[model samples]
Target: MSNPLRLVLFDVDGTLVDSQGSIVSAMTASFSALSLDAPSRDAILSIVGLSLPQAMQNLAPQQSVANQTRLVDEYKQAYHAQRLAQGAASSPLYPGARDVLEELHAQPETLLGVATGKSQRGLDALVEAHGLERFFITRQVADHHPSKPHPSMIQAALSETGVAEQHAVMIGDTRFDMDMAAAAGIASIGVSWGYHDVSALNSATAVIEDFAQLSPALAQLWDK
Candidate 1:
Protein backbone atom coordinates (compact mmCIF):
# COMPACT_ATOMS: atom_id res chain seq x y z
CA MET A 1 0.00 0.00 0.00
CA SER A 2 1.17 3.52 -0.72
CA ASN A 3 1.49 6.23 1.88
CA PRO A 4 -1.21 8.89 1.74
CA LEU A 5 -0.24 12.13 0.09
CA ARG A 6 0.27 15.22 2.22
CA LEU A 7 0.40 18.84 1.13
CA VAL A 8 2.70 21.46 2.59
CA LEU A 9 2.11 25.09 1.70
CA PHE A 10 4.71 27.80 2.17
CA ASP A 11 4.72 31.58 2.21
CA VAL A 12 7.17 33.20 -0.18
CA ASP A 13 8.47 36.40 1.32
CA GLY A 14 10.04 36.25 4.76
CA THR A 15 9.46 32.50 4.92
CA LEU A 16 11.30 31.24 1.83
CA VAL A 17 12.94 34.32 0.36
CA ASP A 18 14.37 37.21 2.33
CA SER A 19 13.00 40.05 0.19
CA GLN A 20 13.08 42.63 2.95
CA GLY A 21 15.48 44.93 1.15
CA SER A 22 13.38 45.00 -1.98
CA ILE A 23 10.14 45.33 -0.06
CA VAL A 24 11.39 48.26 1.98
CA SER A 25 12.96 49.99 -0.98
CA ALA A 26 9.91 49.57 -3.16
CA MET A 27 7.56 50.76 -0.41
CA THR A 28 9.66 53.87 0.14
CA ALA A 29 9.77 54.58 -3.55
CA SER A 30 6.02 54.14 -3.89
CA PHE A 31 5.28 56.63 -1.15
CA SER A 32 7.90 59.01 -2.44
CA ALA A 33 6.44 58.91 -5.95
CA LEU A 34 3.18 60.16 -4.49
CA SER A 35 4.92 62.83 -2.42
CA LEU A 36 3.88 61.02 0.74
CA ASP A 37 5.92 60.09 3.77
CA ALA A 38 6.49 56.35 3.88
CA PRO A 39 5.69 54.32 6.95
CA SER A 40 8.56 53.27 9.13
CA ARG A 41 10.30 49.95 8.43
CA ASP A 42 8.58 48.28 11.36
CA ALA A 43 5.20 49.53 10.24
CA ILE A 44 5.81 48.33 6.69
CA LEU A 45 6.94 44.87 7.71
CA SER A 46 3.91 44.50 9.94
CA ILE A 47 1.76 44.14 6.83
CA VAL A 48 4.09 41.84 4.96
CA GLY A 49 1.65 38.95 4.59
CA LEU A 50 -1.33 40.94 3.38
CA SER A 51 -2.42 41.72 -0.17
CA LEU A 52 -1.18 45.04 -1.46
CA PRO A 53 -4.55 46.76 -1.18
CA GLN A 54 -5.08 45.59 2.37
CA ALA A 55 -1.47 46.43 3.18
CA MET A 56 -1.85 49.90 1.79
CA GLN A 57 -5.00 50.42 3.81
CA ASN A 58 -3.24 49.38 6.98
CA LEU A 59 -0.20 51.53 6.33
CA ALA A 60 -2.07 54.62 5.23
CA PRO A 61 -5.48 54.46 6.84
CA GLN A 62 -5.93 58.19 6.67
CA GLN A 63 -5.12 58.41 3.01
CA SER A 64 -7.91 58.60 0.49
CA VAL A 65 -8.80 55.43 -1.38
CA ALA A 66 -7.54 57.05 -4.57
CA ASN A 67 -4.15 57.61 -3.02
CA GLN A 68 -4.10 54.07 -1.72
CA THR A 69 -4.75 52.83 -5.25
CA ARG A 70 -1.95 54.99 -6.50
CA LEU A 71 0.33 53.65 -3.83
CA VAL A 72 -0.36 50.09 -4.92
CA ASP A 73 0.38 50.94 -8.54
CA GLU A 74 3.57 52.75 -7.65
CA TYR A 75 4.67 49.92 -5.43
CA LYS A 76 4.12 47.35 -8.16
CA GLN A 77 6.05 49.40 -10.67
CA ALA A 78 8.91 50.12 -8.27
CA TYR A 79 9.14 46.52 -7.13
CA HIS A 80 9.13 45.26 -10.71
CA ALA A 81 11.90 47.70 -11.64
CA GLN A 82 13.97 46.58 -8.70
CA ARG A 83 13.42 42.94 -9.61
CA LEU A 84 14.46 43.61 -13.20
CA ALA A 85 17.62 45.27 -11.95
CA GLN A 86 18.63 42.54 -9.50
CA GLY A 87 16.99 39.26 -10.63
CA ALA A 88 17.47 36.45 -8.10
CA ALA A 89 19.85 38.56 -6.07
CA SER A 90 16.91 40.82 -5.13
CA SER A 91 15.49 38.07 -2.90
CA PRO A 92 17.83 35.34 -1.83
CA LEU A 93 16.44 32.30 -0.05
CA TYR A 94 16.98 32.00 3.64
CA PRO A 95 19.77 29.67 4.73
CA GLY A 96 18.94 26.00 4.10
CA ALA A 97 15.69 26.87 2.39
CA ARG A 98 16.52 25.21 -0.91
CA ASP A 99 17.94 22.11 0.78
CA VAL A 100 14.85 21.69 2.93
CA LEU A 101 12.59 22.28 -0.06
CA GLU A 102 14.53 19.76 -2.09
CA GLU A 103 14.20 17.16 0.63
CA LEU A 104 10.47 17.74 0.89
CA HIS A 105 10.02 17.66 -2.87
CA ALA A 106 11.88 14.39 -3.09
CA GLN A 107 9.34 12.66 -0.85
CA PRO A 108 6.99 10.61 -2.98
CA GLU A 109 4.07 11.06 -0.63
CA THR A 110 4.58 14.78 -0.13
CA LEU A 111 3.41 17.67 -2.29
CA LEU A 112 4.56 21.25 -2.02
CA GLY A 113 2.54 24.40 -2.69
CA VAL A 114 2.69 28.13 -2.08
CA ALA A 115 0.10 30.37 -0.40
CA THR A 116 1.48 33.86 -0.58
CA GLY A 117 0.31 37.46 -0.43
CA LYS A 118 2.35 38.24 -3.52
CA SER A 119 0.63 38.81 -6.84
CA GLN A 120 0.99 36.23 -9.61
CA ARG A 121 3.48 38.39 -11.51
CA GLY A 122 5.67 38.90 -8.48
CA LEU A 123 5.48 35.26 -7.47
CA ASP A 124 6.26 34.13 -11.01
CA ALA A 125 9.32 36.35 -11.15
CA LEU A 126 10.64 35.06 -7.86
CA VAL A 127 9.99 31.43 -8.72
CA GLU A 128 11.65 31.71 -12.12
CA ALA A 129 14.63 33.56 -10.74
CA HIS A 130 15.16 30.92 -8.05
CA GLY A 131 14.50 27.98 -10.41
CA LEU A 132 11.76 26.81 -8.05
CA GLU A 133 9.04 26.42 -10.65
CA ARG A 134 9.24 22.66 -10.51
CA PHE A 135 9.06 22.24 -6.75
CA PHE A 136 5.56 23.50 -6.10
CA ILE A 137 2.49 21.78 -7.49
CA THR A 138 0.11 24.56 -6.62
CA ARG A 139 0.74 28.29 -6.47
CA GLN A 140 -1.89 30.39 -4.70
CA VAL A 141 -1.38 34.11 -5.01
CA ALA A 142 -3.12 37.23 -3.71
CA ASP A 143 -4.26 38.02 -7.25
CA HIS A 144 -6.88 35.30 -7.01
CA HIS A 145 -7.53 35.22 -3.28
CA PRO A 146 -8.56 37.44 -0.43
CA SER A 147 -5.08 37.39 1.16
CA LYS A 148 -3.72 35.78 4.30
CA PRO A 149 -5.92 35.25 7.36
CA HIS A 150 -8.88 34.80 4.98
CA PRO A 151 -8.54 31.05 4.32
CA SER A 152 -9.29 31.56 0.64
CA MET A 153 -5.79 30.67 -0.47
CA ILE A 154 -5.54 27.68 1.81
CA GLN A 155 -8.95 26.40 0.84
CA ALA A 156 -8.08 26.70 -2.83
CA ALA A 157 -4.79 24.92 -2.36
CA LEU A 158 -6.51 22.11 -0.50
CA SER A 159 -9.18 21.85 -3.14
CA GLU A 160 -6.66 21.86 -5.96
CA THR A 161 -4.32 19.33 -4.33
CA GLY A 162 -7.22 17.19 -3.04
CA VAL A 163 -5.51 17.05 0.34
CA ALA A 164 -7.61 16.81 3.43
CA GLU A 165 -7.24 19.54 6.02
CA GLN A 166 -5.73 17.13 8.54
CA HIS A 167 -3.13 16.02 6.02
CA ALA A 168 -1.97 19.51 5.12
CA VAL A 169 0.04 22.23 6.85
CA MET A 170 0.64 25.91 6.31
CA ILE A 171 4.15 27.20 6.96
CA GLY A 172 4.82 30.89 7.23
CA ASP A 173 6.27 33.62 9.45
CA THR A 174 3.28 35.61 10.58
CA ARG A 175 0.06 35.43 12.58
CA PHE A 176 -1.80 35.97 9.34
CA ASP A 177 -0.50 32.62 8.15
CA MET A 178 -1.38 30.92 11.45
CA ASP A 179 -4.83 32.43 11.43
CA MET A 180 -5.33 31.39 7.83
CA ALA A 181 -4.43 27.80 8.61
CA ALA A 182 -6.72 27.80 11.62
CA ALA A 183 -9.49 29.19 9.47
CA ALA A 184 -8.88 26.49 6.90
CA GLY A 185 -8.83 23.79 9.60
CA ILE A 186 -5.18 22.84 9.06
CA ALA A 187 -2.03 22.96 11.14
CA SER A 188 0.40 25.87 10.85
CA ILE A 189 4.14 26.13 11.43
CA GLY A 190 5.77 29.48 12.01
CA VAL A 191 9.36 30.56 11.46
CA SER A 192 11.19 32.89 13.83
CA TRP A 193 13.49 34.51 11.27
CA GLY A 194 10.63 36.21 9.41
CA TYR A 195 9.00 39.58 9.58
CA HIS A 196 6.64 39.04 12.51
CA ASP A 197 7.90 38.79 16.05
CA VAL A 198 8.04 35.32 17.61
CA SER A 199 5.32 36.35 20.05
CA ALA A 200 3.00 37.04 17.14
CA LEU A 201 3.23 33.38 16.17
CA ASN A 202 1.53 32.11 19.32
CA SER A 203 -1.32 30.83 17.21
CA ALA A 204 0.95 28.55 15.17
CA THR A 205 0.82 24.82 15.81
CA ALA A 206 4.64 24.74 15.85
CA VAL A 207 7.39 27.32 15.71
CA ILE A 208 10.92 26.69 14.47
CA GLU A 209 13.99 28.93 14.52
CA ASP A 210 15.64 27.63 11.37
CA PHE A 211 14.93 25.62 8.24
CA ALA A 212 16.79 22.60 9.63
CA GLN A 213 14.11 22.24 12.31
CA LEU A 214 11.24 22.10 9.79
CA SER A 215 11.24 18.38 9.07
CA PRO A 216 11.23 17.46 12.76
CA ALA A 217 8.57 20.04 13.45
CA LEU A 218 6.37 18.52 10.75
CA ALA A 219 6.95 15.07 12.15
CA GLN A 220 5.91 16.24 15.60
CA LEU A 221 2.88 18.02 14.22
CA TRP A 222 1.71 14.96 12.31
CA ASP A 223 2.39 12.71 15.29
CA LYS A 224 -0.24 14.57 17.25
Candidate 2:
Protein backbone atom coordinates (compact mmCIF):
# COMPACT_ATOMS: atom_id res chain seq x y z
CA MET A 1 0.00 0.00 0.00
CA SER A 2 1.10 3.56 -0.63
CA ASN A 3 2.10 5.88 2.16
CA PRO A 4 0.07 8.93 3.02
CA LEU A 5 1.12 12.20 1.41
CA ARG A 6 3.38 14.48 3.44
CA LEU A 7 4.06 18.17 3.04
CA VAL A 8 7.39 19.78 3.87
CA LEU A 9 7.45 23.55 3.83
CA PHE A 10 10.70 25.49 3.93
CA ASP A 11 11.72 28.99 4.84
CA VAL A 12 13.95 30.65 2.26
CA ASP A 13 16.50 33.18 3.45
CA GLY A 14 18.59 31.71 6.21
CA THR A 15 17.12 28.22 5.89
CA LEU A 16 17.74 27.33 2.25
CA VAL A 17 19.90 30.16 1.00
CA ASP A 18 22.54 32.31 2.65
CA SER A 19 21.28 35.78 1.80
CA GLN A 20 22.59 37.64 4.82
CA GLY A 21 25.06 39.68 2.80
CA SER A 22 22.42 40.85 0.41
CA ILE A 23 19.88 41.46 3.18
CA VAL A 24 22.29 43.52 5.25
CA SER A 25 23.60 45.44 2.28
CA ALA A 26 20.10 46.29 1.11
CA MET A 27 19.03 47.29 4.59
CA THR A 28 22.03 49.57 4.91
CA ALA A 29 21.30 51.13 1.56
CA SER A 30 17.70 51.69 2.51
CA PHE A 31 18.62 53.44 5.74
CA SER A 32 21.34 55.43 4.03
CA ALA A 33 18.87 56.63 1.41
CA LEU A 34 16.70 58.00 4.18
CA SER A 35 19.67 59.48 6.02
CA LEU A 36 18.91 57.18 8.93
CA ASP A 37 21.31 54.92 10.73
CA ALA A 38 20.75 51.29 9.92
CA PRO A 39 20.24 48.80 12.68
CA SER A 40 23.09 46.53 13.65
CA ARG A 41 23.54 43.29 11.74
CA ASP A 42 22.30 41.33 14.72
CA ALA A 43 19.18 43.45 14.92
CA ILE A 44 18.49 43.01 11.22
CA LEU A 45 19.10 39.27 11.25
CA SER A 46 16.88 38.87 14.28
CA ILE A 47 13.87 39.69 12.13
CA VAL A 48 14.87 37.53 9.16
CA GLY A 49 11.73 35.41 9.05
CA LEU A 50 9.21 38.22 9.43
CA SER A 51 7.66 40.12 6.53
CA LEU A 52 9.51 43.20 5.31
CA PRO A 53 7.00 45.60 6.82
CA GLN A 54 7.16 43.86 10.14
CA ALA A 55 10.91 43.75 9.86
CA MET A 56 10.99 47.45 9.29
CA GLN A 57 8.76 47.96 12.28
CA ASN A 58 11.07 45.94 14.45
CA LEU A 59 14.17 47.65 13.15
CA ALA A 60 12.79 51.14 13.18
CA PRO A 61 10.11 51.35 15.83
CA GLN A 62 10.97 54.95 16.49
CA GLN A 63 10.19 55.95 12.93
CA SER A 64 6.76 57.11 11.92
CA VAL A 65 4.59 54.73 9.90
CA ALA A 66 5.24 56.86 6.81
CA ASN A 67 9.00 56.55 7.25
CA GLN A 68 8.74 52.84 7.86
CA THR A 69 6.82 52.48 4.59
CA ARG A 70 9.51 54.43 2.83
CA LEU A 71 12.16 52.20 4.31
CA VAL A 72 10.33 49.12 3.02
CA ASP A 73 10.16 50.56 -0.50
CA GLU A 74 13.79 51.60 -0.41
CA TYR A 75 14.86 48.21 0.89
CA LYS A 76 12.93 46.44 -1.87
CA GLN A 77 14.50 48.63 -4.50
CA ALA A 78 17.98 48.10 -3.09
CA TYR A 79 17.49 44.35 -2.76
CA HIS A 80 16.15 44.07 -6.31
CA ALA A 81 19.03 46.09 -7.67
CA GLN A 82 21.53 43.87 -5.88
CA ARG A 83 19.79 40.75 -7.15
CA LEU A 84 19.97 42.03 -10.71
CA ALA A 85 23.64 42.74 -10.29
CA GLN A 86 24.53 39.49 -8.54
CA GLY A 87 22.07 37.07 -10.20
CA ALA A 88 22.22 33.66 -8.51
CA ALA A 89 25.14 34.78 -6.42
CA SER A 90 22.93 37.23 -4.59
CA SER A 91 21.38 34.47 -2.55
CA PRO A 92 23.35 31.28 -3.08
CA LEU A 93 21.92 28.12 -1.60
CA TYR A 94 23.56 26.81 1.53
CA PRO A 95 25.88 23.83 1.18
CA GLY A 96 23.92 20.63 0.44
CA ALA A 97 20.64 22.49 0.14
CA ARG A 98 20.01 21.55 -3.47
CA ASP A 99 20.99 17.94 -2.90
CA VAL A 100 18.64 17.59 0.05
CA LEU A 101 15.87 19.31 -1.87
CA GLU A 102 16.38 16.93 -4.76
CA GLU A 103 16.31 13.95 -2.44
CA LEU A 104 13.05 15.12 -0.92
CA HIS A 105 11.60 15.82 -4.36
CA ALA A 106 12.36 12.26 -5.42
CA GLN A 107 10.08 10.88 -2.74
CA PRO A 108 6.68 10.06 -4.14
CA GLU A 109 4.92 10.53 -0.83
CA THR A 110 6.46 13.95 -0.18
CA LEU A 111 5.25 17.26 -1.56
CA LEU A 112 7.56 20.26 -1.17
CA GLY A 113 6.44 23.80 -0.50
CA VAL A 114 7.74 27.20 0.64
CA ALA A 115 6.35 29.43 3.36
CA THR A 116 8.60 32.44 3.41
CA GLY A 117 8.59 36.10 4.35
CA LYS A 118 9.88 36.98 0.90
CA SER A 119 7.69 38.63 -1.70
CA GLN A 120 6.47 36.60 -4.67
CA ARG A 121 8.78 38.39 -7.06
CA GLY A 122 11.74 37.77 -4.78
CA LEU A 123 10.89 34.10 -4.38
CA ASP A 124 10.42 33.70 -8.14
CA ALA A 125 13.81 35.23 -8.77
CA LEU A 126 15.52 32.84 -6.39
CA VAL A 127 13.69 29.79 -7.79
CA GLU A 128 14.41 30.76 -11.37
CA ALA A 129 18.03 31.66 -10.78
CA HIS A 130 18.64 28.36 -9.03
CA GLY A 131 16.56 26.28 -11.47
CA LEU A 132 14.35 25.27 -8.57
CA GLU A 133 11.03 26.16 -10.17
CA ARG A 134 10.06 22.54 -10.59
CA PHE A 135 10.61 21.49 -6.99
CA PHE A 136 7.93 23.40 -5.15
CA ILE A 137 4.26 22.39 -5.26
CA THR A 138 3.02 25.46 -3.44
CA ARG A 139 4.79 28.80 -2.91
CA GLN A 140 3.41 30.89 -0.07
CA VAL A 141 4.95 34.34 0.33
CA ALA A 142 4.59 37.37 2.56
CA ASP A 143 2.75 39.25 -0.18
CA HIS A 144 -0.35 37.18 0.47
CA HIS A 145 -0.17 36.50 4.17
CA PRO A 146 0.84 37.70 7.60
CA SER A 147 4.52 37.34 8.48
CA LYS A 148 6.35 34.53 10.17
CA PRO A 149 5.11 33.26 13.57
CA HIS A 150 1.65 33.49 12.02
CA PRO A 151 0.04 30.33 10.63
CA SER A 152 -1.34 31.97 7.50
CA MET A 153 1.40 30.89 5.13
CA ILE A 154 1.58 27.30 6.32
CA GLN A 155 -2.19 27.04 6.44
CA ALA A 156 -2.34 28.23 2.85
CA ALA A 157 0.24 25.66 1.83
CA LEU A 158 -1.70 22.89 3.62
CA SER A 159 -4.94 24.00 1.97
CA GLU A 160 -3.33 23.98 -1.45
CA THR A 161 -1.67 20.56 -1.04
CA GLY A 162 -4.52 18.85 0.84
CA VAL A 163 -2.14 17.83 3.59
CA ALA A 164 -3.29 17.37 7.18
CA GLU A 165 -1.57 19.22 10.01
CA GLN A 166 -0.16 16.01 11.43
CA HIS A 167 1.23 15.00 8.04
CA ALA A 168 3.02 18.28 7.44
CA VAL A 169 6.31 19.66 8.69
CA MET A 170 8.00 23.04 8.55
CA ILE A 171 11.77 23.43 8.26
CA GLY A 172 13.34 26.75 9.02
CA ASP A 173 16.11 28.49 10.95
CA THR A 174 14.08 30.66 13.26
CA ARG A 175 11.69 30.69 16.20
CA PHE A 176 9.19 32.35 13.90
CA ASP A 177 9.06 29.20 11.79
CA MET A 178 8.72 26.97 14.83
CA ASP A 179 5.99 29.13 16.28
CA MET A 180 4.15 29.22 12.98
CA ALA A 181 4.22 25.46 12.67
CA ALA A 182 2.93 25.15 16.23
CA ALA A 183 0.13 27.60 15.50
CA ALA A 184 -0.73 25.53 12.42
CA GLY A 185 -0.58 22.34 14.48
CA ILE A 186 2.25 20.90 12.36
CA ALA A 187 5.68 19.72 13.36
CA SER A 188 8.77 21.88 12.82
CA ILE A 189 12.45 21.20 12.29
CA GLY A 190 14.92 23.97 12.94
CA VAL A 191 18.28 24.24 11.22
CA SER A 192 21.22 25.25 13.39
CA TRP A 193 22.95 27.35 10.74
CA GLY A 194 20.22 29.89 10.17
CA TYR A 195 20.08 33.48 11.42
CA HIS A 196 18.43 32.61 14.70
CA ASP A 197 20.45 31.06 17.48
CA VAL A 198 19.88 27.33 17.99
CA SER A 199 18.80 28.02 21.57
CA ALA A 200 15.86 30.06 20.28
CA LEU A 201 14.36 27.05 18.51
CA ASN A 202 13.07 25.49 21.70
CA SER A 203 9.71 24.78 20.14
CA ALA A 204 11.15 22.72 17.28
CA THR A 205 10.26 19.05 17.12
CA ALA A 206 13.84 18.40 16.07
CA VAL A 207 16.83 20.58 15.41
CA ILE A 208 19.39 19.51 12.84
CA GLU A 209 22.91 20.80 12.44
CA ASP A 210 23.32 19.88 8.80
CA PHE A 211 21.36 19.02 5.71
CA ALA A 212 22.60 15.44 5.79
CA GLN A 213 20.65 14.96 9.01
CA LEU A 214 17.39 16.12 7.44
CA SER A 215 16.19 12.82 5.99
CA PRO A 216 16.72 11.05 9.26
CA ALA A 217 14.97 13.83 11.11
CA LEU A 218 12.02 13.65 8.76
CA ALA A 219 11.88 9.90 9.10
CA GLN A 220 11.83 10.23 12.87
CA LEU A 221 9.19 12.93 12.73
CA TRP A 222 6.85 10.83 10.62
CA ASP A 223 7.57 7.71 12.66
CA LYS A 224 6.09 9.43 15.72
Task: Please write out the lDDT profile of model 2 over residues 38-144, one tens digit for every residue.
Answer: 99999999999999999999999999999999999999999999999999999999999999999999999999999999999999999999999999999999999
- Strongest candidate by lDDT: 2
Report model 1's TM-score to 2 decimal places: 0.99
lDDT of each: 0.95, 0.97
Q: Provide C-alpha RMSD values for all models, in order.
A: 0.7, 0.5
Clashes of each: 0, 0
Residue runs of model 1 more than 4 Å from their true location after superposition: none
Question: For residue 198, what is the lDDT in candidate 1?
Answer: 95
- Candidate 1's residue-wise lDDT over 1-224, tens digit each? 87678999999999999999999999999999999999999999999999999999999999999999999999999999999999999999999999999999999999999999999999999999999999999999999989789999999999999999999999999999999999999999999999999999999998999999999998887777
Error of 1 at 194 (Å): 0.2
